[model samples]
Target: MASAETDSKSLFSLESYHVSEEHGFILPEPLEELPPYYKPWMDIALRVPELVHSHELRSHVNKMPLLSSTFLQKHRELRLAHLALSMMTMGYIWQEGEKNTAEILPQNLAVPYWEVSQRLGLPPIITHADAVLANWKKKDPDGPFNMQNLELLVRLPGGESVRGFFLVTLLVELAGVPAVRSIPTVINGVRCSDTEAVARGLEIISKSIEDMTDALRLMQVYVDPSVFYGIMRIYLSGWKDNPCMPKGLIYEGVQTEPMEYSGGSAAQSSLLHCFDELLGVKHEPKSASFLIRMRDYMPPLHKKLIQDISLQPSLRNFVQQQDCKDLNKAFDLCVTKLLALRSYHINVVSRFITVPAARARQLREQNHDSDGEIISRAPTALEERGTGGSGIMSFLKTVRDQTKDTLLPEASKEVKHHS
Candidate 1:
């Protein structure tokens, strides 16, 4: 119901941002491979898992031809090229695991990857954009978009768990579709003072967020915690803020100095960023800093959408102005659902990262005959922090707690404000 004038003022719609009505932020009909000329990249890309498994990925990459980016003409072609290059880059860097990271990306892989990344406005490293958005294809084109039918186009060190991790994350994005579709209704309803429309929109968003939390449980069913903690996780990690590659990566042909970029993260997903702005969820300085930096990793248009949403009139203020109980309840429910989603995310992180890390620590303790002999400094990069380099447990808890703060107090719920 948002008018053209309102939409123009806001600078976005789902259509403008490539946010799909059905798939939310998931890229539609993603190309599985680039044109025939880019097969050298594809050849290594499709073999990422096998090469990593055999410990020959670096040797193979060293032998790769420095292919040109000129053949990538279409939008999807560039997407696929970026995907191939990103996976190859991640594999090449971490093929020997985190302790033995390759600091310099070979020119054979770096040049065209850099070129394609420049064209796409993405960093020349694996991001959530590469690992999740551009990495899926359907087992059956006409089939349902569920685990059985969905597949990853490119993979890293993790086996089936890699597919599970990325695809389940993809499904979470899919689950967010209805919430995204209802944003305009919330904004427009607030604009027109249509309490009922605003309430309806808020309810849809609440239910959709709940559905997103439910979709997150799929990680338990599909991803092996040990696999996620040990194998696939390293591939997603970047040199920035990481002790492993302290100087960051040198894209051999592109720059003389090392460039830093964070690893792929859930923060890179625009769903929560958009929701945070629309609903006004305030994060603490530490969490807010990481969250804001993540916006830089997102596609420019997607990042702009969140910025535009923040610049608009506040939905929370609009709800605060209304004394209608339905509007009050709707706003409350939306924030409550967001709070629940954040809590659920913490649980998932604990299951996937926290628990595995603790067990690994205990194993390390056991492996050492004496506790004094247990070396604690190494493996701490991933063991204590997330791939994005935030202190994992504290960061998740902070975000979850901040989400709880957005809920309106019971006394304020039905009060008619004069201001």
Candidate 2:
């Protein structure tokens, strides 16, 4: 039995959370007119410890073995909590009521319900972004990022109640992905429960993932694999909760077999499965978001390798034209390496070389020491041959002859055997 003073102290403890100088938006007060169903959303969030960290929720759902309706129903207790977390986020930046411009109607300046109340008039709708920019201008016309204005805006009594600016930025960043754009819309009179909104958002995002199979697979090469894994986990969790749901089924239609896992930490073990099958990895409760994780795990060299492979005709056009067998094999190896690198390309390369370490040492024992670095200088023979006065035919013949020794080693051998 806690005393009334203790309750007051606990509630007040969160007041010191800072509203950064960058946060210009403010959440409207909680809606007094909120539907009864919305009560669970708000209360469950306050009651559930797991719901507080949205990232953790994503992580936990992903690591599960089989996400099915029964599992989700068991975790149904988390639904409202999930919604509460999302609603708090939405309150900060959801483009609502606003039309072409991003302005909150002055009369409709909805404060959080817990804050001071005034029956403000319903303002005209505008594009939320435009309204936000316009409002920022009105708030601080001359200031750029409006450091001071932003600082003041954040300090506004009721608006400063949620998490820091970083979380908002992270949400905004993810919202740009095509999958998020598919978030379902459920407009019911200017006020919807946060839980409902998040569910809709999640639904759309999950559907989008299902729709963009190829693109998502391509993204595996660019984004963090771990984050991809997390996103997949969320999708799986949703799917497990609703087995009939068509979410994350995009890859199922692709004529490819799913990859199997090798081993690693519970968080990263899925790397093995993802690399084995780029777009065909089966969903594991643990590493469903392996693609996201790969994106996060990618090193700078991985990007460089992808760029080089994409640019080099051998790898780039190979997929399109289906040419040279050796080049095709090399290109496949490159893709595997790109995915397997996860966080450290150097380590992947080192591990790759180990199988032939003795051969490599023997080769090194004879050749010039070229420390794991690729050489790209122009060939001296080409420069000398160009300088010599030779007819185009003769020059070309010379080139053909030289190429035979290097690039055309197999062809040269065939020619010798024929001779």
Candidate 3:
């Protein structure tokens, strides 16, 4: 455990962790392509969604040549490699939707994916890091940063919704830059008893949380609920905890025993973890166990940044000891904003997962067709689980309620009264 004095004395810099002052956790200039020798990955990765739709993805992936990870030297190159391999892995595993799942990842894909994942401190399966943070490229370098100008370098099974799901998430990370930039200010202010600076930083974070929620709203405009639940989702599912692959997947060349990993999840995003640590929000055991496990999925540096922020002198403690109403109020408002953001996340889950799940149930009950269209559509195994493997509604609601628990005594009373 790091002592508070040690944490305060050491300078915590975002750049040290590859977190940008202007882009937060979004990779600054992700390479869109790899070297010529890596053509197999890019060719198959770029065509995943199309190939899957045509039912040729598994065949193409099974035929892929074994490639070595030695040539990927640069950081961005490694990221692009991971993204490409991760996409190929997903398309390969879930090519025939969720029913006819592949149990063994062929040595051609498995060997390189395991190698790159080891080097990057990410799981061999697709993660939020691969799908969102390091997956974007602008249409024009000089153009303004907006949805219209942004696009994914690689795609998954869901066409427009896949593009929308990833790009919208990238924009939200982009919108969080100012808040990330202010983290040091908040910590330094707490260290020196500078209430005004702390308050100012908290306010910026509050507004950024609001902006993130606003950006999340675009999901409605970009991702169709039925499409997300029925089509794009299964491609994101991992072997672990999924009934489709009860024993987990075998990485052929890496290990004889099967390995398990969660699929792409918002929990893998470091932004919320950083905020939760900084705001002193303590989660109950259920949410905490799952969130803690998610850190293993993040880039090591990002996981370190969240851990270091947690060890810093508690901002909540500082505010409570202060004589400044502005400081206390600022802390309260920040927590309140985070609560709203989580609430909005639940709303998103409702539209994309919950509601669609209910409709799938209705359709299944009504259509006694022998073909089982409903089971084939979204995989009955995944309707209750979140993108990762946590219990969908309960996990989110527990997390949201935990955020509410972080409010100061008086603020808790007020928020509870209103809520």
Candidate 4:
């Protein structure tokens, strides 16, 4: 009986060994660095909780030369990453209504922020997609819906204003996890060099992208354009104050400070990044491009898994080798869906930004006297503009056409010309 027990133990050990060997060895990937500005503020928030409540820490953040053209030119990627974190942190806090008044972001931060955001072609407000992809978690020890503990875990040094943003962030994670989680399975299957496995993986990823896209679309109605625009307008006091006004908008803190800089838009969405990675697309290199540094903002393990999967033999390569038209179609379908979602956002934001700008122009023109002497009137607040008009529909269609032209360059010219 003792001999049998020993043999059983040995057999179990042997099976474990074989399994390990079959899987092979993969060194754990290294962690990416967080944006430099993030850690300092986080350290201060952790060590001195009271600092978060005052304007002191915010003043210090404003002092950073994150928005200077020279600095941005030098630290393009890191600066953009920092700008996203800073704005989201501040916007999430201030929008919660902790303090009752609107404050302006100082010029040092405001000008460059607007310029950079424009250069990147992003909107000033944090979109549903941005919050979802940036803050989603694979595992939550606290129940997924538990807001109090989640606030503790996410720990931005803001007051109750963060609650709504936090809730949205949590909702995004809950909505997106199933799709995000399936990514690794797809990666591993492709690594196994099994054509069936590859096909299954492609199907799963395509479906995952579609589901996430649907979840993002649902947010369109829930986001009140007026309220969102109102909040953003209050933060733009510095831009209003600037003689260079309409060049772009700047976010000034509500707590009366002289600091100013540019950039409050949600950084490029992580879903976009995921698409780029999976499709093996590359954009121009900057000192620290969004594609490269955005990973710093992701949860470490999640980022690592994405990196690992990207290094695997690409799905595109596999499709080519197998001559799989179906797989190619699935991949193209995901891209088309993503582009459609982007078009939707462009339409929505054009309503928010372009619609207001157009209205303000019309009001100014209407106020002009017959002699061309303008009768001065207070500018209409963006929120007060009733949601109306085709509002940049033409511009959006042009953008869609350009995107299709760029993304589907190889398709028969007739399809491209149909528009």
List lDDT for all candidates, in order. 0.83, 0.25, 0.89, 0.41
Number of clashing pairs per prediction, in order: 0, 52, 0, 24
Ranking by lDDT: 3, 1, 4, 2
Looking at candidate 4, what is the lDDT of residue 34? 38
> Which residue pairs collide, candidate 3?
none
In TM-score terms, candidate 3 sits at 0.96
Cα lDDT of model 4 by residue, 1-419, tens digit: 01222333222121221112211111111112334544543343342224444545455555545434333333234333333544434443343232332345555455544554444343333332223333333234445443434432233332343334434434433444444444444454445545565556556655655654555454444443333443333332222223323332225532233333222222223444555566555443431243354454443343554565467677666555665566556555555655565576676566655655554466566764423321121123322321211123443454345435433333425445664
TM-score of 1: 0.93
What is candidate 1's CA lDDT for residue 317? 87
Question: Which model scores highest in lDDT?
Answer: 3
List candidate 1 segments past 4 Å from native.
1-12, 368-378, 411-419
Residue 393's C-alpha lDDT in candidate 4?
47
| Candidates arranged by TM-score, highest first | 3, 1, 4, 2
Q: TM-score per candidate, in order? A: 0.93, 0.19, 0.96, 0.48
Please give the RMSD to the true structure for each candidate, in Å: 4.2, 27.4, 2.9, 13.3
Better of 1 and 4 by TM-score: 1
For model 1, what is the error of residue 87's alpha carbon versus the real structure, in angstroms, after optimal superposition?
0.6
